[model samples]
Every structure is written in structure tokens, then in C-alpha cells.
Target: MPRSPHRTRMRLAALVFSLTLLLVMTTLGIIPRASSTTTAFSFASAGDTSTLTAGDGLNSLNRLAGSRADFFLGVGDYSYQSSMTGDVWCSQFKAKYSNIEIGPGNHDTGETNDTSGTRSYERYVAGCSFTLSSQVVCGPVAGQCYGKEYYFDYPSVNPIARFIMISPRVFNVTGVCTTTCNAVAKSPCNDTTGCWPYNKNDTHYNWTASAVDSARTTGIKWVVVGMHKVCISAGAESCNIGTNLFNMLVAKKVDLILQGHDHTYERSKQLAFNSACTGFTTNSSYVLYNSSCVVDDGSRGFYTAGGHGFLKYAVSTDRIDIQTDFAGTYQDSFSVVSPTTSLSASFTYSPASPTIGAQVTFTATASGGTSPYSFDWNFGDNSTAQGNPVSHSYTKAGSYNVALTVRDSAAPTPNTQTMTNPVSVSPTPLSLSVSGPSTATTGSPVAFTATASGGTAPYTFAWTATGGSPSSGGGSSFTTTFNAAGTFVVSATVTDANSQTSNASQQIAISAPIPPLSASFTYSPSSPLPVLPVTFTGSATGGTQPYSFTWDFGDGSTATGQSVDHSYLLPGAYTVTLTVTDAGGQTAKAYQTVTVTIL
Candidate 1:
């Protein structure tokens, strides 16, 4: 189900050259570059690939494809079997993935050429195309264009990352020694021409250094270098990529370094190349162990191990996540986080104990993130609002968890922060009502009662009236008397324990005071004789109703009723009196002399 690996490698090599030209065109402003907008993208990296005939190699490939990466970085060591080109790896890979970017390895160019007179390294470079969002750039040297040394900026414009691919220890198979031709040797080897090695003086090393510096000046957030030889690994492969390049990358603060010579998967702890860690030498046996330069050890999720897998990178402006996975199974993972502050939010609301139908004002405050933040609220009553300061009212009173979610304008995706707090809604507000007689007589004491209800109990009342002595009183009940007879309003305000208040007023009608009582009396005749029958009548007014009368004749006798008859036995001038008493106990008297002698 595959074609010859040789054909695949040749095509890939041509593709790399064409990609280099594309990058050059981009540099000349011939093509449109990416905008400042930050977009999330992913890629997978691995090397030492074998045919998909069986084993973990095929599964690893499937896993890389299934990851749905934007591109695949072939770290090198393609077609481990002899006579096979890159078809065993590329045929299935190209069908599954969108693009592959090659970084040449020693094995790719060590052996003899194929029947078509094409080297595997050259074939790989020509076969794999560089079609990622990043712009590919060729090496500065005239001959070093593809499969030798190159670099690219991911997301072209305002790029956050720069990837430099180089072959530090690579050699072409020569006809000097057929027996040892397959073996990779250092410069001045017995079989072939001198190989390109990793050192400060090497062309590849110089290009890599320049690329790293340029990325920093251009504001790139991350720099990753890809090579085929092992610089530091748990595998048996020596540090063939040289200590100078490794130290340079580390000192420059390169974020990640990927290589493929070692078939087993291995990742290092974050190491520093400062004076504390000491510098690495050209000794192949040197390895870093228990060094203070380890900024973060394999302890907090960052790991170091040996296995068969690939590294998947999910890159964004704020962070880069790396996962070592094989056939859908992940073995190790770590994150390279940006130093940007984390987003956080908090909120405060007015009327801590709000009643039903009361408007609650919620003001949200955010911090530690990008500017131009958006706010949203969930009132827990199935109601929602947006903006920094929002208002909401609840129909029913109860406790609810109010949530405020704030989003900032961070690149790739907006950062979000949410905060929840409990709000207790009061059942009802404090109310007061004053009740008394609707009509009252002037100068009479009127009893006014005030009733208060609702709101955190233990309420107090303040009574006030338009016309009344002691116009203000405290407590639930108040009494006031109106001196004048007119319509007066009596009001009472009740305040609950929470200091919430409500008022109610009542109108009272006061009439004028009653007049004093008076009494009058008259006899049937203008003059009456005591000897004869005398009649007297009494009446009263201006006091309460139901009057009683008492009549005293001059003959020294008394009678009770409104009208009375009396006769005097002796004829003499006597005093007669009539006393009228109203129901209110107000008495009035009237007197007259009766001539009873010779009438």
C-alpha cells in the first residue's frame, strides 16, 4: 500500500526548496502575510520514523494524524530500512495530514544513493512541502537552501514563535569507503568528505544564532530549534549536535528543542545555561544530572522519560502546551505559560436585604487582565443582565446566588472570570398605619393607634400630625388630641430593625365644642296664687340631651318633671324655683315669686 521511499524523499526535497522560495517571496512583500490577530494552531513533532508495516511506528503516525495538527515536523531519521525511500512514512502521513516540514538527519544522507541517483536527505527535503501558516526562509549561504539549514516564523506577521531547522552533524555518502559508507562520521572521516558539525564557527550554528536574535528583536514570544542529532537524551546516541549549539540555544532562552536521532521518546527538564549551571564542553560523555540549573524538575507535571512517541504542541499567544503521546495515549505533558497576569473579577450590590420589586444595582470590578472587559450577570431568578453596572428586580423574595462573569480581550480567545455571592431578598417592606375615630369633637382627646408590620421586626414608629399637640411620638402606638375643629391628617412612619421605613396617614374630622347649658321656666298664668293650683314648666338647651326639672313652690313644697303643679296652703309672697339638669350633669336654675294671697 506504499510507493518507494526514495521517490517520496525526492519529492519532499523539491517541496522544501519551493517552500524556501515562498518564504523569500514573502520577505520581499510579494505575498500577503498574516495579520496581527492571534489565532490558535497546533503541530506534531517526531523523528526516527520507520515503515507503517507494523509496530509502534504506525500507531505513532496514526496518533499524530488523529491529533488534527496543522502540520507535522519530521525531525529526521526517515526510512530506517534499506532500499526503502520515504513512501512508507510519507504516503500514509501525507494522506492523513495536511503538510510535513522536514529536518534532515544523519541516517537520511549517510547511506549510498538510490538507483535514481538521489540521496534520501535530498529526496526527503524535496518531497515534504512547507504549507503551514508560517513563512519559510532559506539559509543565508548560496547552497544551503533546503534539507540543510533554514528557519521560519509561525503565523507570518506579528509572529509569536520562530522555528529554526538545521543539520549540525550531517554527512553525504561518498565513494571513498563502500564498507563504512552507511556509517555517520565526523569531519575528515576515512570514507567521505568532511561533515558539517555544530560549533560557534559552523555556518549552521551561526545561522541559528542569528535567527534566535532576530526573533527576539521582532517580539517573538517563543523560539524552537529542530535538529536530527541528539544533544541530550536518555538514549545511547552521543551528544553529536555539539555543546556549543545546545548552550547557545539554552542561553538565548529558546523555549524548546526537538530532535529525532534517538528512536525512544525523551524530554528534558527546563535547564538554564547560566554561570550557575556551568557551561557544557565538547565531551560526548557529558550529561546534566542533579544540577541547580534545572529551573523545574520532572516534579510538577513537567517530566523526563524514555519511550516511543511524538510531541504535540498546541500554541497560542499566551501559552504553549506540549504532550508526548502515542496512539491516542499520552505519556507526559507540560506547559510553557506566558507571564501575562491572570484575569480576576469581583462585584458589589446595593440594598443588602432588598424586598420584592426593589431594584438592585450590581456593580462589577475586574482586574489582572487585558483591557476592554465585558461583564454579564446571572440573577439566579432565570434573569440575566449585561454591562458593568446592571439593575434587576425579583418578583419573589428568597436567597439567590448572583454570578458576575467578566471577559477580557485577550488574543486567541477571551479570558473569563466569574464570581458568585449570595443575596437575601426580604419578604416585605416595613409598613405603618394610624387608625382613630374619623370624626372627633374639638377639645376632646382622640386616641390614635399605629400598627407596623414586615421587614426585620422590632419596628419603631414616628407619629406626626397636621393638627395635634405633641405632634411626634415614638413606638408602635400614638395618641394625640386636636384642639381645633377641622380636617387634620395623622401620619405614622414605621422603621424596621434594618432601618427600612414605610409611612401611612389618616384624616380626622374634628367638630366645634358644645355650648354651656341654660335653663328657663314659665307659669301658666302671668301670676299665680299659692292658694290656687300653680303650674310651672322648665326647659334646657346648649348641653347634652335628656333634661330633668325640679319645681319648688313658695308654700315650701317640691315636685319633679318638665311640667309640675303645686298649691300653697297659706296666702303669702313666696319664692318659686325651677332646676333643670341635663344628662351631662350640668344644672341650670330659674326662679320667680308667686303672689298667692288675695289673687
Candidate 2:
């Protein structure tokens, strides 16, 4: 029966649609993915395993399974037996841990009498490809990964760590050195047999460098390298991993290096190449010739030669702690922490003392830890903002402790640093009070002073007056003379350094000057007797002109005019008083005594 073309087209269309949907889901992160953050996680690692059917291998597997690890790393040499296939090892491993990563060991490769297909290396690749199906392969060829060299990021989505797996000298074959080949492939032909020197320009070296550089550029907090052969170890194993690779790893500041080949477990101290030694020989017989060349002589653990144990790693954003569980007993432990986790934060604000309702800018800076960093600001006024360089305004005057917290993009737990600074906000003080005489006579100099406070210092005063000479003046104090008598107003405006202005005004009264006025009177009746009229005369001078007078007799008689007569009806003695007024409203008084007797 011929297949229906239309049906076939529909099926193809459906397949395309499904694939597109899946892609969209993955891009949007709607699909479940792995996570590798600064968050803490644990894993187990080991190499050179015997078949887990029985014996020490089973015990080690049991210990690793009980480790409560998120994943397991098979460093190399699975099943020790060259005839054992990789799938068989994975079958036993999968029962314990579903997530696993593997790097090939010498026994797993075509070394000695073992051939490529027969060795467990090829089988391990196939098994791991299935177990870790989502692993990203970056080998020289497409899908040609996990067998010899490859790299993967944990918790693939937004990973915080990268694991680089490499096989340097796993294969021993007859081949000329090439830049694209592993160390053994580039090994020097020593008389066509026996010993072979390392080649610096090899596939593993170049790939490792590129991988490490990429991880750094991508801001991966941790870079871990895993292999099956030891380079610089306290164990009896030769430095088969090559010298150039070791130095490169150290120079790159790789967080940790995991390898397993020797039957005994060993760990090297934090070592740094002094550049004293050019290269190290890979032969087992080679030993350190100079004590100065050794930075740290690390310890070794001979867990009964073929230890039945695995290494457990507790990893965090900044540190990785490792411990060995061997023969049901705790053996070795060490810690490897990244120095980049030291984080410090600081912030600076403009306008040291801000005024209420004015904007203040805060810029934050951080040192150490991985970036792209995040800034969180607590403006100290119950307000919050995020991001570097933020602005805020205070609604009231007070002292606020502004806090800035900077967090770096580290996984499992980002490095956080908090810093606090006191910010003082002052109330607006750009007001002024005009003070001077409220009443001044004509031609009198009246000092008008403007007193200002707050809103930044260095206040300037501008004075304006009405009905006064020199009506405008500057500075805090101004003096002006009033030329005419009237009710006038004095005003001053003060401006502070911040360009804030305030105004004040005072009403003043001005009058024309008055001259001295005096009043004198002469009485004709200085010795007048009772029942007689007393005559008085008054005159005045000074003050504004045209004087008027009034005279009063002490015995209750009063008279008006410049001169007046007053008589006491009955009195032994009588007093007469006269008052004079000038045009300017000035007044003066005079008094006279008269003796009055009965006629």
C-alpha cells in the first residue's frame, strides 16, 4: 500500500510544530532544567573501581550511595578489569545515583593488550551519554564527546559552575605528535620504544585552556577539572597527566582538580609552580630533586592499598570541602575555597547635608566577588531602591543611616556586603526677619537688619524701603534716612547659598523734626489781692511757629489766649499756669505764684 502524501505532509507539519513548541518552552525556561547556583550541593567522586558485584568495589559503591549526593563523578578506571564494559559499571552506579559524569582512565582505554571497542572507555561513553542525556558536547567532532574529552555545566540553566573532563595519556599507540592529539599521541618516540616525553602543544592542553578561559569569561564562579591520571600527587602514580597541563591549571586558578589512577588515595596541598622547574618527567621513577621546587609536600593515605571508598564533596558558592569515606571509616579531609569571594561594599552621596524635599544621589561601589553585581539601597527613611547610583529625597529633617547592600552573581549563595552611612537632612532655613526702628524722625538714619538662617550658609540680604533716602541696600544690615514724615515700610529679601530666598518686611513711622519750644509768662497780679483780676502774658519760641497759649488760676478759673487774666474768688495764695503750643505740635508750660489777700 502506498503511503498517503497528504497524511505524510500533515505528520511532518505536526512534528515541526511540536519541535517549535519545545524550543519556545526551553527558551522561555518553562521546561524543568538543572540548577547550579551559589547554593550548596554535594557530590561523590572516585576512580579505579572494581566490579560492584562483590568485594571492595561494592563496599565503596555502598558508601558513595549513602553519601546523599546530588550527583556522582566517575574520575576514571571503572571496573579495573580491562574486559569490563562501561555499561556494566553504569548499571551498578545508576542503582545508587541517576546523575553521573565520567572521565576515561587508562584501563578503560586501549592500553596494553586492550583494543578500542573492547575497552570500557567506549562503553562508558555510551552509557554516560544515555545517563546524562542533556550533556552538552564540545569535542572536535559532533557528538564525539564523553569518550575522551568533554565539558559540562551543572544545573545547566544559569549554571554557576563548569566541569571540564579530559583524557590526556589514556591511550598508548604508535603515532606522530600532532597539535590536535592528546598527550600520548604527541609523545616523543624514544628510539621507537619505551619512554616517551610529553608534548606541550596537544589537544588536551589547548582544549583545557579554551575551556577555562570560556568559563571565566562567562562568569562561572567555579571551574573544576577532572581526569583519570595524576599529575602532581603524593601517590606512586607517575605524572602521566603532563606538566604543561598542571601549570596551566594552576595559572588559571582552577578551583579544584580531581584525578584517580593510583590504588591509594592522595591529595596535594595548594601548590604553585615557582617556575624553577621547566617540566617534570612522567616516569614513576622520577622524584623531586630540589627541595626549593616543592611548595608543599602533601600527605598520602594508603587505605590498605586498594581502598574501598570514595570522595565526598560539599560544594558552595565560595568553597568546596572534600572528605574520604574508606573502609567504613572517615579518612582524609581538605577544603578548597576561592579567594574571589571576599566582597566589600561602599557608597557615596552628593550634598553631604541634604535639605528636605531636595534630591540626593547615592552611588555604590563593590570590590571582590564575581560580577555583574547587584545593588540594593535602603535610603534610611523607610524607603528602598535597587540598582547602582540611585536618588532619593527626604520628606522630613533627621539623621538617617543609609545602608547599601551589594550582592555578586555567585552560585548557591551570592556574596553579600552591606555598608551604612549617616545622612543628615536639614529643614529649610532660608527665612529672614527685618528688624529696625519702627518709628524714625525725618533725616534720621534707621538701621534695617536682615537676619537669615538655614538652607546653606552665606546669606545675602537685599533691603528696600519706601519714603527713605538710599532706598535699596545690600548685605545683612542696611541703614537709610527718612526724608519725610509718613508711615513707611521696610522690606528685606534674603538668599542663601542654595539659591533659596525669603522675604521680610517691617512698617515704620517717620515724622518731621520738631525744634525746642519754651513758654514764659509774666503776671501783673503777682501780689494781687482777693476779689481782684489777675492778668497773665505768655510767649514761646522754637519748634514750628504760631504758638497759642492758655492760662489757669489755681482757684479753678481758666482762660485762653497768649495772655489771660484769672481771679481767685477767695484765697490766701493763688497759682497761675500757662501752656504754649507750636505748629509742629510741640508744647511747653510755665507757672507763676500770686499772693491774694482780702481787700
Candidate 3:
């Protein structure tokens, strides 16, 4: 459970200070790098960084990640998550790319055969303790967190976007990497011997579908899906045969698919995953090469690079520049954009500014797009809507940005047309509350303290009292003395930094000083046994009668009335206590002990 806002703020203050210090330290080479700034973020990636090869391929990639990339993401096989490779390679990899994000690869998971591979990968790659990886484990996989699926959003980008990572699943029927059902890599290709357990029938496929669908509806500029297994690749034998999963990504308009597994680098033209229509075969006899499904259309953009060559990507709201680098040289580069990327959709929020629980209606308008547009809305708070004109109410007060992605049409490839607007909800205005004695003697001085909440801080206070002389005043609290016995009103007005003001008044009743009261209690059967009842009588002196009595049996039970009885259920020495509240609202307490023995 989360703490109250006040407590959370206090806790955050200390953390904020620590982070600020750490931020400076990281720049000074004390701590590791953190997430990128909201303006821009770049990253490097690769798959098959197997230590078994014993080459400097990963060293070159590590240099790229350490110097130029804001972070590093692996397609899967880093050779760091497997017991076979041990922790040396993984630790070195992490040391260089401290902020690395990844999906489990076959090599990382014991060549897709050993369960320990999954456990090791989960502990190292997807562990919550990897504070630098941006490992955002949201929602559930297989009804509970398997540490294999997670998603994150970059809200600070020119147009906010989301990235999703899903685990490679076990094949429901044919135990082959979904993408490599038949395209198993040939000689010099480790894939032919073993492959990922991914299959279209597995739950992960549905998870991928649901993720891309939700990303589209949430107004994300791009849904970049990543995993360790290549769906389609070259320079490596028979990669993923997951035509079913590819088709789903294409239909959901997934903008990017980052994959690994093959030992080569190749780029496919924009194409769909429709193997049935593309005339690709599922049998290994015909689908001998990566050219089976030629990239020609905008369905599945299959790109692969071999030999530890890393991929670098510069992402933005306008365009994405992708490059495959091997030995520090660029192998291929490409750019991608949607036709509706230039389109815009904006919404106007009623009241300009909102208050807690206020119903704010957002009216959307789209431009630079064909008519009959479809609107997908993201309110920036995890909730979403689809209609052009939507109404929402917020429970908390904070500034929020609402995103509206409008698509001109559904047929063919839809473009990304986003129009964003921001709304600020103010907290329930400043409130003033004063706490002090309710009753006091005539000509006596009483002290009161005033407090303010819910508005900008650094508040100024003004105090006023009737039928009383100010003994002291100013700054949230004051002391006042009364001369006559009467009811007096004390009001406190508070003004915040924004000059907003509110006032609250409390009534103080002054009377002739009553004699101080003395409280005493007597109980029958001072030496009682277990389960025996004892009656207690409370006596008081010098105060108004018709007093209320409260008694504590000290055995986890309580009673009320001037005289009452209680019983101890267990054998023990207990204290019987009484509190007498006089008619004048004065209270006094007294206690007595009783021994209950086991009989």
C-alpha cells in the first residue's frame, strides 16, 4: 500500500535530494548512467553475443553502448544469462552497458532446453534489482508475473511512445522458435541445432497482440516490440516461423520489431507477415533461406545483422533513424514514418483548469488528415478513451497531458496523427484549521495554533478573536486572554504564495473557573479468580455531577457508566482504570490493580 500524500512527499524529498546528488556523481563517473532525458534517447542492440565464439565482437558493441548510446537493448543471446557461460561475460557486459534492457534468448535460457536458463535469465536480465535496466514489470504473464513481459512509455518525447518486451514462448505443437518453424539456420548457424521454444499458440503470442493493440489505442506514436528471437533474418539459417505473430503485429500497426538470433545482418523491405499470400512454405525443404518471404510491402519489416554487429537507433516524434554497425562501421541504415505522422489532433478541455473530481470534457479536432478519422485517446494516467469528445474526472490534482492519435482510415497502413493537450487540476483550495482549548477560566490566557493545507506553501496567517484581548498574534497561532465568561469566536485567515486565501473560525467558551476534580475508583472482590466478575465504582470530587465514567479492565475490555462491572477472562495481575469527565468537560483518571488467580 502507498503512503498518504503528505508522507509520500516527505519520503520523496529525501530521495529527490539523494538523486540530485547521484546525478552529479554519475556525471563525475561515480555512479552508472541512468535513463535518458525526455527530449531525446538513443540506443544500441544486438543478439548472438555468444562468448563461445571468443571474439572481440561484443567488446566493439560494448564500446558503442558505453560511448554513444543512451542505453543498450539486446535481442536475447548475450551469453550473460546462462550458467554455461557463467557470470564473467554477463558481468563485463553489464559493466559496460549498465543500463541494458533485454528479452530472454535461447542461449540465455539454456539453449531453450534447460529451465535453469530461464531462472538465471530472470535473475539477471529481468530482475527488479537491475535498477538501471528500465525493467518496468507491469501487468501479468501467465496470470502472474513470470518476469518475462513488461512495457514502458517515454512520455517526455516529442510525441510520447511506448515499447513492449515479451518472452519467447514454448511451442504448443512444434517445439521451434515461432519465427524459425522451418527457416532453421544451416551450417555455421547454431540455430539448426537448437531454437527458441516460441510458438504462435502460446500465451505470449496473445500477450503480444494485446500489447500492440493497447499501444495503438493509447495514442502511442510507435509500438516497438522486442525479443531475443528474430522473426525473419538473413546471414543465419531458418529463423522464426511465426507468421501468425507477424501477421498480428502488422495488423496492430506495430512500428518497430527489434530481434536477434541469426549470426548475420540483413534488412527486408517493408512487407506484411502474410506467408499464405506470399507463397512461403512451412516445410524446411523449400524455406531453405531467408529470402522465402521477400520484403516488398508494409506488413513485416524484417531486418537482421550477423557477427556481433550492434544496431543503433535515433528515435523521435518525426522520424526514426536505424543503423546496423559491425566493427564500428555501418552495415545498413533506414528511416521509417507513417503517412499520418504529419497529421494532428488536438482537444480543448473545459474550465481551462480543473479541481479535484471535476468533470472535464475534452473536445477533439483533427487537421491535415482525411475526413472520417478514427480517434484514439490516452489521458496520460493509464486510462484511455476512443470517442472524439470524451469526458473524464480526475481524483488527484496534477498537470496531465492528454494524447489524441487520429487515423484517417483503417484500411491499408494507417499513419500516426497525434495532437496533444495539457490540463492542470488544482487541489481543493487552501483550508485553515485552528486547534486550542475549548474552555478556559475568566481572565485566563489560552494558546491556539492554526494550520493550513492544500495550497502553495509559505503561507501567511491573520488571527482575530472576539471578547478577548490579544496576548500575542501572527503566524498561524496566537494567545488570547478573556475577561468575562462568554462564548468568543476566533478566526484564522491564511494566504498562500498564490495569494489565495481562506478562513476558519472556532468558538471558545469562557466561564468562571471550576474547582479541579479528583478521580478515584474502588472495585469489589479485590482478589478474584479467573472468569470471575468484579464491580468497579468511580468517585470524583469538586466538579459538576452527571459525570460520564469510562473504565478499562486492563484485560483488553472496557466499560462505561459511573459504576460498572468487568471480568478478566485469563489469570493475571491487571489494572482497573477509570476516567471521569465532568459536566464542564473536565476529565480526570485514576487506576487500581486487581489480582486474578487460576482457581
> Highest TM-score: which candidate?
2
Clashes of each: 21, 11, 28
The segments of candidate 1 whose C-alpha lies over 4 angstroms from its true place after superposition are: 1-39, 111-118, 173-180, 183-194, 266-307, 328-330, 339-599
Winner by lDDT between candidate 2 and candidate 1: 1
Off by over 4 Å in 3: 1-39, 52-55, 80-86, 112-118, 126-129, 132-135, 142-147, 155-159, 170-202, 239-241, 267-308, 328-330, 340-366, 369-599
Candidate 2, superposed: residue stretches over 4 Å from native: 1-39, 116-120, 130-134, 172-203, 266-292, 295-306, 328-330, 340-345, 348-357, 366-599
TM-score of 3: 0.41
N/CA/C clash count, model 1: 21
Return model 1's CA RMSD, one decimal.
Answer: 20.0
lDDT of each: 0.67, 0.66, 0.60
- Regarding TM-score, does 1 or 2 come out ahead? 2
lDDT: which candidate is best? 1
Each candidate: RMSD to true structure?
A: 20.0, 19.5, 27.1
**Local accuracy of candidate 3 as per-residue lDDT tens digits, 102-177:** 5565545444433332234444443322334333545343332322467766544433567776655312111223
Summed over model 3, clashes come to 28
Question: Which tens-of-lDDT digit does each residue in 1-599 have in candidate 2?
Answer: 11122111000001111222222232233332223336367777777666576655566667667779878877776654445567877777778667777777655554542343423355677676535434665654344466556788875666667888776656532222212223443445342321222345555467778898899999888887777776644446556766666656655666677777655443323233346656433334222223234444344432223234677777777566666676534344545544453788999998887899889999998888888899999988789999878999998888999999999988878989999999999887677788888888999888877888767778888889866789898988899998888899889998878788999999999888766999898888567776677778888878778888887777777889986766667767666788888887888999877787765
User: What's the best-to-worst order under lDDT?
Assistant: 1, 2, 3
Candidate 2 residue 151 C-alpha distance from true site, Å = 1.5
For each candidate, what TM-score against the reference? 0.45, 0.49, 0.41
Q: Judge candidate 2 at residue 529 and give its lDDT.
A: 73
